[model samples]
Target: MNELVLTLGWLGIYAPMALGAASSAIGCAIAGQASIGAMTETEGGYGRFIGVSAFPSTMVIYGIVIMFTLNRDVTPENAGGLFGIGILSGIALMYCGIWQGRACAAAINATKEKPEIFGLSLAPAAIIEGFGVFAFVFALVISAGIS
Candidate 1:
């Protein structure tokens, strides 16, 4: 029993951050591809702008994890803490990007046919961004050592 516990503990101590990072990276990549698909399928020529706009947010997320790792005494047992923080931030950025892309697409369509409906079409996107911001705030709080 003691040996099993020890083995489990050791595994726990070294697995969370690594697994979380890989999983989150995969999710972020998928989200990125989805966003690109949205832009390319809609705007046809705004791929560069969409790519550039999304880059900063993604980099910021990666930087947050790197900085946290560099500055903290992270271990597998506490890897959940880091993973939670990263997840929060990544979700926020991804949500915002997806929402904004949708809004932009809607606006483009509206302008081509009914300009006055632009404001209505934008409401959902803006609301989605708010949810992302809320997630970011909560994640920041947790990552800042509130746990």
Candidate 2:
């Protein structure tokens, strides 16, 4: 049981970054595909599509910050905190990444049809990023409370 607890604690320490990177990769890929499609359809303004596709990459950065914030000596006393914080934050970031990708893809598609609304189309992705930021902030605050 002691070994299991310590192993899980170690898992907790790494989970955020691993999960976050995966989320970002998937999100970026999804949006990037839409970006490519958009580029093929439009004659100009390629930069905005690339920019929108990159929005979901922020989740990976947030995950990195959360992982570092949660990095402390994990003993039996702190294992629960590590696990809860690491896992919960990872899940939140992953969801945010996925949804943010979808949102970005939508933005790219819509803006491809109506170039004038490009900035406005990004609102949903920005809002999704806000949720990821909340999770990141919550993890950091809670991790500070742990020993």
- RMSD to the true structure for each prediction, in A, is 6.8, 0.7
**Deviation in angstroms for 94 in model 1?**
1.9
lDDT of 1 by residue, 69-142 (tens): 42444455445555555544554555455445545444444433554564575576557556555654565466
Q: All candidates' TM-scores? A: 0.48, 0.98
In model 2, the number of clashes is 0
Local accuracy by lDDT, each model: 0.47, 0.90
What is candidate 1's local distance difference test score?
A: 0.47
lDDT of 2 at 33: 98
Give the candidate number with the greatest TM-score. Answer: 2
